[model samples]
Target: MLNIPLMSNNISEEDKEVLADFIRTSDRFTNGPKVREFEEAWSQWLGVKHSLFVNSGASANYMTMAVLRELYGPGEVIVPPIAWSSDISSVFAAGFTPVFVDVDMSTLAMNEDEILSHITDRTRAVLLTHVLGLNGLSQRLLDELDRRGIPLIEDVCESHGTTMNGKKCGTFGLASNFSFYYAHHMSTIEGGVICTNNDRVYQMCRMFRSHGMVRELTDEDMKREYAEKYPDLRPEFLFAVPGYNMRGTELNAVLGLNQLKRLDGNNARRVENFKLYVKNLDPEKYFTDFRMDGQVNYAFIVLLRQASREKFERLTELLRSENVEFRRGTAGGGNLARQPFVRKRLPDFDPSTLKNTDFIHFYGLYTGNYPSLEKEKILELCKLLNRV
Candidate 1:
């Protein structure tokens, strides 16, 4: 039996050679060809003015929130509870409180009503995650945010190629973060990118991602330094805003650049795989596909029928016996919001405020998407999972 896990890194040999060359050189500084090339490629792909590479998606999210706080500090970030644990922690790490909102189970994005209920004068940003590659959002929400003058920071970690009303998910917000973890829509081993059109955000994020070092200066900063010196601008590797070491390696950047080249094809494969799963699986046996139209699904995800803990174990054991892999669900349970650490840190916001989180823990699991598994393998896996 073939051992098909949740994900497989499909790194081409052609890409590996590119990474090997950058690794032998061993210089992450200077904003080299690979770095800029990656940024340029992603920027063009997402149709944004700037894309800043970072070590991980969590770092990208943290840096983005830090940049926001620098521009307008000590604010609140609204996020959905029924989602990845990273989305919540990153918000708190940014020195902003995370206001938990419920999810419309069908969409798995933020619940519009719950979002509005949480917003206040302190609410400065809304972090929207295109959960599981399904983009279930309406333009009405964008309009509401625009009217309120609050910025939207899209957490496009799960959704790289998803669209809403013909515009890409990552480009809709003022700034966004993308993950390239092994199981994501795409992978660069372990790397992430932050995208934004605002020059200030881009420069600040670049500096923040690299411990406040600005190798690639925006025009405004160059002019400021030039005014201080005579012929050439003096070096100012000074700390502007306090930052972190979140820079991506040149080797990883090369990998990401290669992945970026085949993103459309890769996501297309995921979309087709999702259609197959939905078409083959019993609609009554499983809940509806937690997918929205136009989503380039990152995984063939679903919600299970609510069952007893013992039955759950039996179900998983049965699948494992069949050599079919399944995910451990996305939501953080037991130790997430209720644990001593989170309770100590976030005592003000009651953990019970996120009721939907518990539901997410039990029912959610994905047969994560990857390009390596052929269509036949996927069909077999789903056929076994959909058994009555």
Candidate 2:
């Protein structure tokens, strides 16, 4: 009779008051100065040169890939089977073929070996997601990708404040995406951001966020150059690239700026909560050996050590009987490689090679792990799970 839901309402009364104040006082509700302010603050927080606020995390994914395609042209994007649908969809949307790779059991990220093996002349970029706030990056992966001059695009929507080598996850890649959706590390009602150190990538993302308008370009010199290149068209109305309108509103920006202030503190609590969960879990029955050096997981990832259909079903049944909410297959519902969209593209794609992803697809489940989750509740949940 626990009745534990996956996530609690994280938006606070103070947050609502701020929104109400903004609504009462501010006339400009569209994408404007507030959005830019949030973007700059986010960039500073993530240690990136620039950031672009988008309507949603999916838009952030598509914007990142679209900018990548614009800068590097169409080719293959190496991706993990255990990722969000948008991560794969964005690649296809940008006219790049997705080369699937098996994820590591420990990190739930693209296996470094699998990624390295898939690289070819056609390899464009590696779209890596830091699933559920777990750091999906490695120094070797960074060094290898850097050596080959292959851009690493990180999808860190579920992860905020997770780090590797003292540097944040979003700062490692050519461009990275973050979401400020409900129950995440932070909330902007519904918003996302694209972070990058590269100037060209930043400029492209700015244009892409707002219908590819040259006016969106921040660098005055770039704007003038574009204006001069297309003398026939109005400089303010010029469409630099085939971009979509994925801009975040001023209201979203207001919420983001407020939530961002406490993000780091909340993430710290989440990290500790995850560690406690792993420590208390029955290791013989569950896979509790995740790479936890600098992770701030937003959810408690539970995976069976062995593939037993009975165990998996029993675990689900127990959780439901106890009114504990959970989702099977972890992030994005297990192996995205087996999803119909992927099958349509790569008809002969083999699932055998993706043993880790396949196992997770059938045996893994993630429960709620918000900052406010009680330690006693977590301990109780583990006790129930151990019985399975």
- Which candidate number would show the highest TM-score if scored against the true structure? 2
Backbone atom clashes (below 3 Å) for every candidate: 0, 0
Candidate 2 residue-wise lDDT at 53: 92
Q: Residue 363 CA error for candidate 2 (Å)?
A: 0.6
Per-model TM against the reference:
0.89, 0.98
For model 2, how does the per-residue alpha-carbon lDDT over 173-272 read when each residue is reduced to its tens digit? 9999998888689999888999988999989988998889999888999999999999999997999999999988999999998998888889989999
Q: Model 1, range 1-388, lDDT digits (tens) per residue?
A: 5356777767778778877776787756444677778889999998999999887888888888889988888988887765566777777787888777777776677787788778899998998878777885778888888989889999888888899877898998889999987667767888899999998888788778867654445766653654455334344655556788887877777888887888898888888887777777767656665655777876666566564566556667766787666675553332156556557777886766665555556656666667656888777766776763
Over 4 Å off, model 2: none
Candidate 2 lDDT for residue 134: 87
Each prediction's whole-model lDDT (CA): 0.75, 0.91
Candidate 1 error regions (>4 Å): 21-30, 213-216, 221-235, 306-310, 331-340, 348-353
TM-score for candidate 2, please give it. 0.98
Give the lDDT of residue 98 in candidate 1: 79
